[model samples]
Target: MSVIGQAEGIEHGTVRGYKQHRYRQIPACDACKKALRDDRAAARRGERPERAKPQRTSRRKAAEELDAATEATPVLLPVPPPPQLPDRPEIGVPIEGADLEIGDVIVFLGNHHRIDRFEPYTGSLRAELGEGTRVACAGTWGMTVGPTSTVRILPRPRRDAR
Candidate 1:
């Protein structure tokens, strides 16, 4: 059987060699019949459905161009200052290791302090004649090692580093 006829036969159920039956001739509505015929004709003519067009882009090339455009331009950024420790002393405040030692006269940035006594086993220190309580420093303190040999602490020692 021809393809178009077979297709039409499937839609309307009218086979060429089959005996007539009440169901075979059940008339199809005009619109349905015409649509099936059009589809079959289109299939025979080999007409393809239209496809969506592809998009074009030069983003990467544009970015490279931009980079090249700015390649010769110089950029300036600010540098950050170094971290600093606080001056003076307080009680119940633990300092790592100890930056000060007993007998060390430290001029804190804002005030002056001298560690007259420091006990490593108990992590306690006496500074400023005990005015500064439990002073914290960064290294271990030992006897005979005085402030003259180590860094000093002075609160607001100079106009800078305040």
Candidate 2:
């Protein structure tokens, strides 16, 4: 039966209208009704009871339990093995002037920033990879196949020529 927007901030007219329209309206909580009944009973007896205090748990025991739980579980994961490069000499050799295409898995040999990721060349040429990420090429190079051969580059999609 609690309302809003009146002298007590409850909409009195709306409450009255709702009560008139509905046969069984204005639903109230059981605990609130029980509290009202208890108040009435206490008033009739002319006795008021003090509120009950909450129980406290040991902080040291709680801390010990939390520490035991944290110790039981592992926080860090196991590190994985590094990526492997192709064994062939021709494909493994770094080309002086040749820019890597999409699908070309090149092992970085230069000492600049020193990371061991296989640089897969795509048609787009622009690699949207984060810095310092290491990758390995799965395909091996044959004597007949060059760096841009279908055997080595056919696994991934290539960008359309402009």
What does candidate 1 score on TM?
0.18
The best candidate by lDDT is: 1
Question: lDDT tens string, model 2, 2-102?
Answer: 33211232223342332221212222223433454466588589774443445464999878877997888854433432333333333332321123333
Q: How many clashing residue pairs, candidate 2?
A: 10
lDDT of each: 0.38, 0.35
lDDT by residue (1-162, candidate 1, tens digit) is 333212244433222112111123222333443454475588588763434445464999878866886885764433332333332233111111234545444443434455666543333443422432343333443332222223333311223333
Kindly give the number of clashing pairs for every candidate.
21, 10
Highest TM-score scorer = 1
Q: State residue 128's C-alpha deviation in candidate 2, in Å.
A: 62
The predictions' CA RMSDs to the true structure, in order, are 41.0, 31.7
